[model samples]
Target: MPAAMTIDLSAIPADQRDAVAAVLRERDALKEINRRLEHLVAELNHAVHGKRSEKLSEDERQLSFEDLETAIAEVEESQDTQLSSKGKTRRPVRRNRGNLPKDLPRIEHVIEPASLECPHCQKMGGCGVMHKIGEDRTERLDIVPAQLRVIVTVRPKYACRACTDGVTQMPAPAHLIEGGLPTEGAIAHVLVSKYADHLPLHRQSQILARSGIDIHRGTLADWVGTAAFHLGPVVDRLAEHLKVSTKLFMDETTAPVLDPGRGKTKTGYLWALARDDRAWGGDDPPGVVFFYAPDRRGENAEKFLRGFDGVLQLDGYQGYNCLTRPSRKGGDPIRVAHCWAHARRKLKEVFDRDGSEIAAEGLRRIAEFYRVEANIRGTAPGQRLSARQARTVPLVAAFGEWLQEQRLRVSAKSRLGEKLAYIHRHWDGLQTFLHDGRVEIDSNSVENLIRPIALNRKNALFAGHDEGGRTWGRIASLIETAKTNVVEPFAYLKATLEAIAAGHPKSRIDELLPWNFTPSS
Candidate 1:
């Protein structure tokens, strides 16, 4: 539908002018509806086969398009139903929903007819035999409400017949929550539900209430605090483990914390440090450790990265300018490698605001870098270095020359000029990947890991206190790191809690980590 056109309603009769205004309003609504539909259609086409600076993963694309199309359908209004034109009654396509897993326990319901014998056979004095030759089977999914069950521990008393011996029984087994109602498995479920599932304590309490269990959200917080206390050492170990790597990705997000002194919420931070060696096929396993700090001061980052001495790939945050210093107290100066995604995004913003050919060309050049990265992604670091040097070196040189030429022609005050300036200012860090194969082109590794924290933050709104923020970081760190290792969080956490309660030695603490996860462990 076209936009509503302006008309000389004042020249017409007043009575008809009112009707004309109403029609104009309706036309505007239609125009808006059409616009919404067109936008969704464009995104759908893009997901299907679109021009992009980077490609979304296959699973990501599939899930995205499916949801996008469903939303498109749900946006239809009553007038849209009437606009079907031909309204041809086409058969609804039967999509193939894959078969249910064989491992899933199924309950059988044998539906039988009142009479097995055919009516014709009975009428003909049973001349034809109605015997079973085969059985038809159909499977549909069903669900049972989750039920809470109690585990009873029996410690029978034993007595000696002579000498008035005291009654004796084996000592009760230790639990993660000492003498509390929840078992290790139950605590693990609660932790996973809150952190990974992003269900706040109040919501979880409500969920537990549905199962006839009365648990206060404050008690849930206590449980989480206890879990945090025991998990602190583990998180410390994990952070130290991450620091061992020569190169790592880093980023931070705001964590709103309640300030009891002022009786209101204050901004905090959860910094993510990540390592993904599979990109260059290195030996170190992937992991992420989140640190919660009261503020995003330079010292906070500096403290968190004390032992980490090598390249840190991150965004254009000036707080990390301290790392650029030639001389720092503790160890060798931490080298900073800035993100190309950040640089590209600067120009992409310009392109979005106004269709600038310069911005488009800049994005095109960045896209070429990603294209090369896609091919040699899983190769070894030395091999990646060889590929980048041979292929990306000349491209980078050409891009730099082109950037300088454009910058000279445009004013520094312009949007395109400002973005080009950013690239030029961070020219050394932007080319860091070309020099060191171990470092990634961007800090996306850590950014991807931090997304759940954002989701959790949104749901919970804010942490109750400074300690609450720290507790959030500790539990989330282990859960998300488990995911990076392809380990199921519930299982890993359950086993770890059990192991801790059973007095697993600190000397072998690494045994309880996610990578060592096994079903029977």
Candidate 2:
């Protein structure tokens, strides 16, 4: 159906024919090379100007330790079992139909036919009798808009008739905001909506107006500040708990605060420290606390982490080097555990930009380390240490040797060379997991914890002031910690606010922590 090309050697000179063929081959090769070059340029542009989440997709390959452990066990069990000689059969994958909460109330509606007479009988009411056969049922979710109402407290006064020495009246119930318009539940709702759901105060006020509640945004801010003031003690306890941990995953993100005098927003840092031992099967409950600093200087990190001596997991930021220095005061030097994900990110950028084989090999080598980690994850600390020594130690040594060899071969100023140098400089820290089983390969857990703050930042744009940023940090700490512990944040906040209003003792404040919290309590 198609025409075919035919070439005749006799029609053309021999020397010219060879030259023509060479030119055609060269053109084809140039076209392919130009295509690749264009692709590389596009990838570089996307990396430099596109969204930051492109890197997150690459990092997601490093699964959580618990999940990796389960996968490893399943693979091992399958390998140990006998296989059938018959060809393998594949089963269909079932799609998930999400379930509604069991606690949610359900409303039922029943429908019956207009006439109960059977069509076959053709008699009125089917011989004057009808029986039910079956019913088809369907369910749909519904919601009730938030309702606003007043809670009137009546404290009737009584006087003694015989002796009017003194008049006594029943005491009024305690409220989070004394004589304030909103109730404890209302304040809790606002806090959860603002911080957890990232709804700004003005937007919440607008929503409330639709319900016929004429509350000002300023009043909502006052309620938030009041709630933060009462929750201060609990946040303090959370900070203390986080500081005492032998290991912590730390990261920081920028938070802009409004400057009244300058009429512009100033940069601030929201420092996040998280502890999650469940990945290693430890008994300690997972929690995270945040601190807001005016800047991202090393001193802020030093001040925040003062009186703490243990492994501090983070990315390669020079600010943290002070904590790891021997001359640091108040405690032993904090061991720095650098994130391999960061190094992999550097290599990933290089690979995306130029498609270098060295960068690809570096990623492959790092992936191997993660593969060994997957096999040993969630085991006892001692067992994990032994497995790393036997399995991971050699791979690290070989990888280090390969890195050194590549460093000597490549130019120091090249991008791939720079990434290799970074790995060499942080080699000890990157291999910290080989020394201790408790340390993770990266600080992604804390990074994941900080994602909500990033979301809030995108919504709110900036904080009102330095104090407002601090309040954001404090409130986010409690809400995020509650989420980490699987506690319903709204229920926890409502109960905690009520307890504080009712004069709950600060000495027993730990009882109100997300881990120890119960709705009834």
In order, the Cα lDDT scores of the candidates are 0.85, 0.84
Q: Write the per-residue lDDT of candidate 1 for residues 1-109, one digit (tens) a residue.
A: 4455689889889889988887676666666667878888988988887645135644467678889888777555433643443363433534556678777898999
Best by TM-score: 1
How do the residues 1-521 of candidate 2 rate in per-residue lDDT, one tens digit apiece? 23434556567898799877765565555455455556555654554466443554332323333344455445434423312112333234334445677677888777877877666677444454468978786666677887678888888888899997987998888999998888899999999999999999999999999988889999999999999999999998988888888899999999999999999999999999899887688888899889999899987888888778889999998888888888876678898899999999999899888889999998999998889878977888888889889988998899999999999999999888889998888988998988888888888899989988988997999999999999999999999999999999999999999999999997899988888888763
Q: Residue 71 CA error for candidate 2 (Å)?
A: 34
For candidate 1, what is the TM-score?
0.84
Q: In candidate 1, residue 77 scores what lDDT? A: 44
RMSD of each: 7.6, 13.7
Total clashes in model 1, counting residue pairs 3 or more apart in sequence or in different chains: 0
TM-score, one value per model: 0.84, 0.80
What TM-score does candidate 2 get on C-alpha atoms?
Answer: 0.80
How many residue pairs clash in all the candidates, one count each? Answer: 0, 0
Candidate 2 residue pairs in clash (backbone atoms < 3 Å): none
Q: Any runs in candidate 1 off by more than 4 Å, and if so which?
A: 1-96, 118-120, 127-131
Residue 315 lDDT in model 1?
92
